[model samples]
Target chain A: MRVLIVDDDPELAELVSRSLAREGHAVATAADLESARAALVEAFDVVILDLGLPDGSGLELCRELRAAGASVPILLLTAQSAVGERVAGLNAGADDYVVKPFALAELRARVRALGRRRESAPSVTYRTGDLEIDLSARRARRLGLEVELTPREWVVLECLAGSRGRVVSRDRLLEEGWGESSEAASASLEVLVGRIRRKLGRDAIRTVRGQGYAID
Target chain B: MPSTEPGRPSSGGRSLVRRVGLVAALTAAGASLATLSVAMVVVDYRVTSDAEDDALERARALAAELDAEARAQQAVTQAQLEDELREFSHGDVTLAVWEASGRLAGDPALPSPAQDGCEASAGPDGAWMVCRASSASAGRWVLVGEPRSQLLAHREPLLLGGLVALIVVVLGGIFAGISVGRWSLRPLVRLQGALTAMDAAAPQPAPSLPRSGMVEIDDVAATIDDLLGRLRVELERSRHFAADAAHELRTPLTKLRTELELRAEEHDEGSHEGRQLLRSVARVEDLGELVDHLLVLASPESALRGASLVSVSALVEAVVEDLDADASRVRLELEDDGAVVGDATVLSAAISNGLGNALKYSKGPVRVGVQDTAEHVVLRIDDEGPGLGEEARARAFEPFYRAPEQRGTGGHGIGLALIAHVVAAHRGDAAFVDDGPGAHLVVRLPRHRGVRPEQT
Candidate 1:
């Protein structure tokens, strides 16, 4: 996953970026809202924004990103974390607020939580016995650790999970997930199912003979 | 007594009733004396006039009797005429008869009487009133005379009685005047007492004094009642301002505290450097200190006390937990949960605002603790926030006044003012202590030392 860190404190930014990088996530850092804006032009899974930026308030950038329909989760990191600032940060479309001098472990936990929430479905949490797929939160948890899924995998799973134990045709999965006609295809439905199996395990999805697929 | 007039006490100090009373007493005495004097004179004149009339009647009767006797015999001897005159004579009266020749009967020293009508004269004896009438049978004149002293003999006692009555009227008037003056001052005295007592304990329902029978006094009482009502309203407004100040400042304080806590880490250790990390661990503490003070300054005083036994430590812990700042930053290091008699809800309301404010503006890793003294329970919230300056502390409770540097910060400026009201209402005190690294807000409430250990 790629993430952008917006902050005026270059040292703090580097430290936070290095910590996140150790988790196998690619990170981009911006010193101010201007560079942050330019950095946001590229695709990123999440953003770490600082409220007290040298160029301008991080609130403006957070708001701008939300207004422009960027669906990536925002985690605000600031030194002056007052109650009102937290509320304002949330109001500006920040998914989470973490005060300065915070534990690195806590910040990482919150960022992951935000990312998971962004990947999940908002309205429904699909449950197949012990395995639950929260579409709004966009995280699929089986046993304990979540089964991470890409955006396309999420769309495909959403179609299958909506079947509620019924079989869904491969054609439907392609149409819903990729928005492509039945005749057009980039990745085959069988190959997508194989990737989901590797992450979720074989029992998470079931093949109905020659007709279609379903999740138990 | 509001106006000062020369030759008169100011209306505020003057007793009009006393003046009215004195004038009434004097006038009554004077009028009574005048009426008694006129009555005495009339009594004297009527008595003397009546006496003179009686003498004239007596003279006529005597003249008629002599004429009848003279005519009956065709002649009256001088000796018989003298006897007849003597018969008509009595005490204070003398009779005389006149013939064409000379005097015929009665006192020879008595002067000739006027035959036309009655006349008064000074005789050798005393003042005399005389009347003469013609003899019916012989055409002779007969006169009867009386002294003036006989007519005025009964009037001396009457004058004496009049003098006594005048004295009584004057004394009675004075008494009445004094009584009226005191009765009129009753309302003012009571009003003064009521006003004096208000400073110690303001009567909630307000004392509604009965109206004085006097209209002016009643009017004054009404105005005082109106004044009391206005004072109560002003007090209530101050209480509301306290609550509002807490509400207005609490939100921002919460944000600040949260933001600060997020930046703190384990030992502030970092692998990268461009900007120095807050390594002192106290940078956050300083911010917390300032916010903690501000929180206490934003609540209403009345809301800070209750009538139950409250454990100060537990209460502080709960309130701090409720704050919006990161919980990891706040460390509860309380040795004593000192007990106090107060309403927990009321106390918590005050605590909540302060906590909210601290959460907004202070750095995390804050320490909230409790200390108990002999007379009071102290709740202390210590944080690493910028401490309040000496100048800000002095006028901290003034409404709508911010520090010069904070003028443009979006503050409604009633936070500390409201807290002052809360402290006063609950009979508690709040102190913003500047102790080195952090600002400390210490709230002291009167302790309860009774059997309330098991209470909330």
Candidate 2:
């Protein structure tokens, strides 16, 4: 896997680059928006962009890259935890966002997930036991009968299914489902996963204890 | 921002309209009464004086005629004099003839004449004005008397007219006072309308107050506008300060966290250095969480920009399930699934904070309940812990305020404050009820009916 990290702070950028490289990925670093654009000429698996840069905002760079027909997955690194800021970032064509001071393990997991998602077209549906999940249509069925799930329930279910049996961390599920991964949201995630399990069968989703949940 | 200040004069007294009317009426009545009394006295004096002069003139004329008759007859008898006196007597006036020897000769019913040209004397019929005339040729004196009551008879109509005038003046004064009162207060009423139109909570500036062309009212409106503008600037400054501080600290914190993780990975699991590194990482995470809370408090609107409908029962059940081992200690009873409209993340966070406090503060089992009413959806959490004192309860919602007893519990003291802020933003109330045997934290939010299923 190849990765590009764009940030104005050299210390943070160097640390992240070294960590990703140590994980056996070809990692590149850019100190500002201009260097990031120059480095983007080469192909990369994932682009980790910071929201604030010395020369310009990373949002503009994201818009320009997307407008120029680059579909490579881009994950945003933002210090602001505001809903509006995240919404804007996603709306400007970023795939996901991680708030500042994030754990290195969590960042590695997100990067690996983003890189794997680009390797192939996502499966349109998932089936286990009597439960069948249709990702494209956003519907679920049990014993060939349509099952009802609230909007929040569907989001949590879809995130787990998209991971292709990989353990989707609790915090990642929270960010995907509730747009935030705060301590308070962890409780909601736990309850949401329980409801999904009851609807699809107790064995449909497995909990990875102290880590997250997975669907096989 | 409210206009009701202590220095402002109270309108609790008698209304301006009534006060003006009363003053006008009293003044009108006083002036009219004084004028009427003076006019009546002067008119009475003139009438009485005229009556006395008439009586005196008649007496002299009668005496002159008697003298002429005596001269004509050469020897007038007493009987003839009596005949002349009787002929001269008329209605409301009588004539009396007195001899030079001080003897009354005609009209014995009349009072004895006094020695005076004209004088008021008490007579059998009320009081009379009497005048004396002496004729030397006839050796007789003629006295004419008239009642004083007849002289003042015209004053009765004058008194009736004065009474009518006084009533008219008083009524007119009241009407004029009322008109002036309404006209003068028009500007103040307009000022009140302008004040009521302003919405203090809105992000937009208040509309400019319309001018009433009155100096005092316009001055007040201008001052209010100035105050609101200054307040807005100060608020904007503080919000920016919080946001900027958070942004500046994030990069360094991220570097520190990444360094700690890398160093921890190099050592064995049970090594002291590895354990200390992990603990330092946890502390950094706590600091990051604090920054997030500060940003939320500084700009709650930005946090709630993606609001949607959320079920209270579902959220509560989720928070309880996350408790894991603590779940066994919680007794959950959900009576309603009513929804409230707000950001799901924020609402859940607030609920999580509430439940976390109960579990942290109490050793015994906690009871959590949800109920819906006509207007509100309530979430009550009761913990078997020491209840807050009166002073603690009052200051519980203040940011970073920790009760003295709860200081060593290892919390940032912002959990309850965050709950208060989020609940208030959703138009809800959060408080510690005084239910006995424990501390009861109640959150009541306005129920949102007919929420869309997809949104919920």
Candidate maximizing lDDT: 2
lDDT of 2 by residue, A1-216 (tens): 999999888889888988888899999999898999899999999999999888999999989988998878888999986656776787687767788989998788778766765654244687876668775344566666544455467657777777867999988787666667887688767767765654455576799999999987
lDDT per residue as tens, model 1, B96-162: 8886787887776566665645877777877767788887567688878766676566587888888
lDDT of candidate 2 at residue A72, scale 0 to 100: 84
Instruction: Output the number of the TM-score-best candidate.
Output: 2
lDDT of 1 at B287: 42
Off by over 4 Å in 2: A18-24, A119-190, A193-216, B1-183, B203-207, B267-271, B300-306, B312-337, B400-414, B452-456
Per-residue lDDT over A1-216 for candidate 1, one digit per residue giving the tens place of the 0 to 100 score: 788999776666777787788777899999988899899889998899988788889999988987998888888875432334564786687766765555566677667756655655345676764467776445566544434344456667777777767998877776665546454353446656755654455577888986788976
Q: Please compute DockQ, using alpha carbons, for every candidate against the native two-chain complex.
A: 0.02, 0.28
Which residue pairs collide in model 2, if any? none
Provide the lowest-lDDT 10-residue window in model 2 chain B: B1-10
